[model samples]
Target: MANPRNPNRLPSSSSSSSSSSRSVASPPLSSPPRITTSSRAAPPPPLPSAATPPLPPRLRPPRAAPPLPGLRGLRLRAPGGASLHRTARVFPSPSSYEFEIKEKGSHLLRLHFYPFVARGYDLSSASFHVSASGFTLLANFTTADPVLKEFVLWIDSDKLVLSFVPAQASSFAFVNAIEVVSAPKDLIGDVAIVPNQLEKFNGVSRQALETLYRINVGGPKVTPFNDTLWRTWVPDNELFVESDSTSKTLSFSGRIAYQKYGASREVAPDNVYSTARVVDGSDSNHNMTWVFPVSSGYKYLIRLHFCDIASLALNQLYFNIYVNGNSGYGDFDLSDAAGHVLASPYYIDFVADADNSGKVIVTIGPSKLSSPSWIHGLLNGVEVMKMNNSIGSLDGDASVVLVTENPVKRGFGEFVRSILCGFAFMSLLGIVFMLVMRLRAESGRTVLWSPLPTDVSGGKWGQGFPVASGKLEL
Candidate 1:
């Protein structure tokens, strides 16, 4: 449904009591910061003592926000790390905050919610609808602690509207903060990827560019203040089930990394190259893997970050990559891939269409290609992004091709007469054996398709240690 926001319904301005609450002149702006203003009026004072001279309108500052608890000392802080715990504009009734963005392109909108007692807020009654520019960002959502979600928006105009509406009477709706950041253009198109239809729907576009996880594998969290582009890179420990049991993921000593995805300069912090996740005693039969929890059926663009900081010689380390049992990249030797270079940034991007399990199993194992050199697989960073295709592609809606194209059956006679006959027979057996191994892995493995064990009815907040409950229950 379209946004039903009526500015006339905004909460009335509250009285000012403190010196900081006093307003200054609405700074001389060529134009207002917000194109749309609230439609509420300030409360009137007792007939403004007839004995007093009327004050000039320009001299009077705008009415200050009503005094409320949990609001003091909580000013908006710079956004970079896991969103801060304070800075809020609480809503007792329907409320809205509007902003104007001059840049027109794909933009990422971040909403922060912290259900604390800072503003006499009823944490249990925090159900509400959140919308941006008349589009739904969150609906009837409730949480126990601080939570943040990011969305990719394609803004065509400068005017933007963000609003909150309580779901039930007396239920207060509030926001800790909001942010709008520039995103890569063409990353999201207006075309919708309708299933069963092979083409873009009506030539319109769609984007599934919401960020699910951006992590600095094996490293500490990097806040926007320390990052190159004010981006937040969380540590992988928070989300992955790692095979390594060590107290720390293996460490590396590589140089700086420079990366560019689309038009933006997405640089990995220098610290990003200092650490990596490397499992010991890994082999070709079973590779070390990390399982991430995700929603199923949606398409994802999984990007891997690498920097040979270990100073390994040429072909010193070789590994194979897998995504949900499929070969993401086989026999990937980082140094060889980089032309035997070191201390430089290298990355690979793959698009995966999730299946019913909703989980993506990523494995990095020692490959025969590097077995002669003797080393293990290691990773520096990772990003799993949702895709927004203008064509009829929604991740799972994508089809996989397993058929192999080969020379015509002039081969049928060649198989019996050529020198490759013995070798070809062994190759066939190898394929069969690999198939058996894959089947065994599938049968032995469990994937999560449901909520975590700590998932409560109204919130997914942490409780005790989160244990994997086998595979998702569909």
Candidate 2:
């Protein structure tokens, strides 16, 4: 769908009053900045009195209709402290928000939705589909409260377009705010380790990802303001199962060594790497585990952050990492992983599938290769991002057919294979038919005389021949 023509608009999402409501202008064409805009509109001015003197045609104002009820803007706040949920812009038909891209890389797209009574329309009753850059981000999506949707897209084009289409003509579409920010170039890479597979999984940067969970192990919640990318990281106290009584939280007060080849500050804040959840050395046989609920039948990109702050010497701690009972990393030597430097940040990425129970369990247990007195395992932070299904959708099981390959290329390959198979089948049939015809002609070449030319005139051996009567004529 294209941008709506003369679409009805709402109040400004950034302001507190409707008087200042206006559409957010596009950023300059110099370079894409880490900022965004929203859709808004200003209410029409009141009509002048008849007693006033007649003014020029150009000076006279156009007639304005009375504003609809419930069109007034309402103030609200999201859990992340974003004030963009105060107002929204409603579209009676299909519409879009377009952006010009100056640099081509991965960009963060965040959408805020706050359903309410807008004018005479019930925003909660509205069902719509949202798509961006030819990927279906949402399908038949609706909500009662404020909701935020975030996605990371790989854009190698000059423009990024977002379209919103209502499910029905009677229904409407709306948005409170939209954010488009350039993410770090190294935020996402092209490769990951997959469980049970000997080969590495590549092309991870090509797929669109939806943020599922971001957790700071053994630490307090880190809000968006504290993160480099305005991301939120919640604590893992509730996620950690207390039944495993052999685990505890560990904190470091020293500076983290940020190596040139290791994780950077943009990858994770220092607060996340400073604290960790580690297994107590008392119970060497037990493991520290954290369970998370996820949608079944979908794969997730799991990133585990590690900083060896618990160990005092190099090559002292050896542990194993497991995902859903499968070995993700066996005999993981933290000291060796961080290049024999304690407090250096290092992370690992894995592609894991959600089981039937809709649970992804991560366990860190002591490795048999380590001494019994060594600390078993430790983790600093964890991030889980959901990968788009084969149908190219992040929401529901709705299949959206995407044109990823050129039709001409696929058709030519298929045509060549078909022609080769046809020739092979015809050649075999012709050989069998020729062999059958030759055998028939060879059998008919030989002939046998039915009755022997024996003498029957009684001059020679006429008695040896039998007559047509029952008795022989001897």
Candidate 3:
């Protein structure tokens, strides 16, 4: 019924004459059902191509790890979710395959292993060892539990050799995935290493340097997305050796430390700050040491990164830092020295000359005071920068201190070492030592590297590639 107040309403057509006309024009309600359906129903829709519903954007499996990028390995099932699943790689043999990277610099090496056992493999038989360019990255590594590893290495030559040796008991070893990202030339400082000129304190000229190692003292390897420079700072666990009980800790307390130095989450974007290594308070004499091998006669720069995440006073944690047994920093305190918890980080840098032994030793221990220091030894990050005295400094965000002191006096021992290195080892002893040095040589196995020209345009972020998981694994 139309409302009487509505002016737009149509006039009622219920007249005897109109009713008669409608009855004549329209069929009775009892007409056949088929005819009525044909008159009023819509056309059916076209059949669908697929049976199941489409996956949601997030649920869809991502593109699998870029076709080998040059290494050869079977693909494993990564159960860390589709994100990590697609990035998984597996090298079935106990021995490893080495890849050739044409360019050399400080590169971030990321190795991922999701501990989930696949169909045929037993997790218990998964122990193995890994090394890159003669430096052991992980030894006695196991998949008994899931783990993610990241490392920074200097690629000196045109090629990098990556080797994996599974334990005798374990039939095979594998890596779920790997990433080799190029890092900034100067890991800690913006300046470059240049040779000494006339004005320097000592007659010794600075040696050309490169980054042999960069470690995230207490943290996991940060991914490209989380890091502004996409730098990979390896966890110190592999190199960390406890002396009188030193321990590595991950502190939620220091999570926001980078912000204090005016860094936004995007810049200091990873969970690395919360992790740290500290000396054991219970031990009377605790120390933390890491050793690195290098070519003889080169000067190096070592940087120690620090941030106090513990809930103690500034002076509570105090220690001394040493390089090759020489005291570099006498008294180092984190909390007392660094007022902010998650603010920017603090670093101690030193220039060191590698002795004829071709090795550099870095150590941290309790202070020399007769009474024990308030806290314990601690470290957050470490960078071994190679100095290029000839080139001077470039732009990095680290501070470096050069010690132009008298070179450590060496006698006849130096002469003997130089001569001995040139001569070949005795046949029997050389073979024995070679086997003992598991990571020193590469076997006949060669990496496919790339059949075609290489493509590194992916840069730090893996541009043009959809391996979002790789970026997230920083």
Winning model by lDDT:
2
In model 1, which regions exceed 4 Å deviation?
1-87, 92-95, 118-120, 133-135, 168-172, 184-206, 238-248, 257-267, 279-285, 314-317, 336-340, 353-355, 386-474
Question: In candidate 1, what residue range of length 10 has the lowest lDDT sum?
Answer: 1-10
Clashing pairs for predicted structure model 2, backbone only: none
- Across 1-474, the per-residue lDDT of candidate 1 in tens digits comes to 111110011111211211111221111112122223221235434323453222222221233223322221223232333323433444545545554555676666666565556434455457666656435555566877556566666667875566566655545566654555544443343443232234433322234355677777787765443432234677776555644333237565433444343211233555566677764433335455666667665666666777766545666777778777677777787876665666556766666666567776666766765553355677877766665443322233221110011112324545656757788888999999999999999977755564555545566556754756555554
In Å, residue 345's CA in model 2 sits off its true spot by 0.8
lDDT per residue for candidate 3 within 1-474, as digits (tens), equals 211111111111101110010000011122111111001122212213342122212211112122223344445553555344233344444334344444566554555565556666655467556655545455556756444454556567855555655533324566554444444443433332222222222321223234456676666664332333333456665566654354657555433555444323322233555567776556547678877666554467776766666534445666888877776767765554555443346665577777568777778787754145344677776766444333232112111111111112222445567667645456668878879676554533323332233345645533354433322221
| C-alpha RMSD values across all candidates | 29.5, 15.2, 33.8
Error of 1 at 360 (Å): 2.3
Of models 1 and 2, which has the larger lDDT? 2
Candidate closest to the true structure, highest TM-score: 2
Better of 2 and 3 by TM-score: 2
Model 1 TM-score on a 0 to 1 scale: 0.54
Segments in model 2 whose C-alpha atoms lie over 4 Å from true places: 1-82, 399-474
Per-model C-alpha lDDT, please? Answer: 0.51, 0.68, 0.47
Q: How would you encode candidate 2's per-residue C-alpha lDDT over 1-474 as one tens digit per residue?
A: 111110112222221111111123221222222223332334333323443222212221111112223331222222433444545666555656666566687877777777767457676887877877767788777887666677888888977877766655566667766666656667888899887678887988888888867888888776443444555677887678889756888888888898888887668877789999887578788888888788887788889999988987888889999988898899998888888899999999998899679978888888998786778889999888888887777877654432222234435656888899899889999999999999899867755433444665746547554443342223
Better of 1 and 2 by TM-score: 2
- Worst lDDT run of 10 residues, candidate 2, spans 1-10
All candidates in order of TM-score, best leading: 2, 1, 3
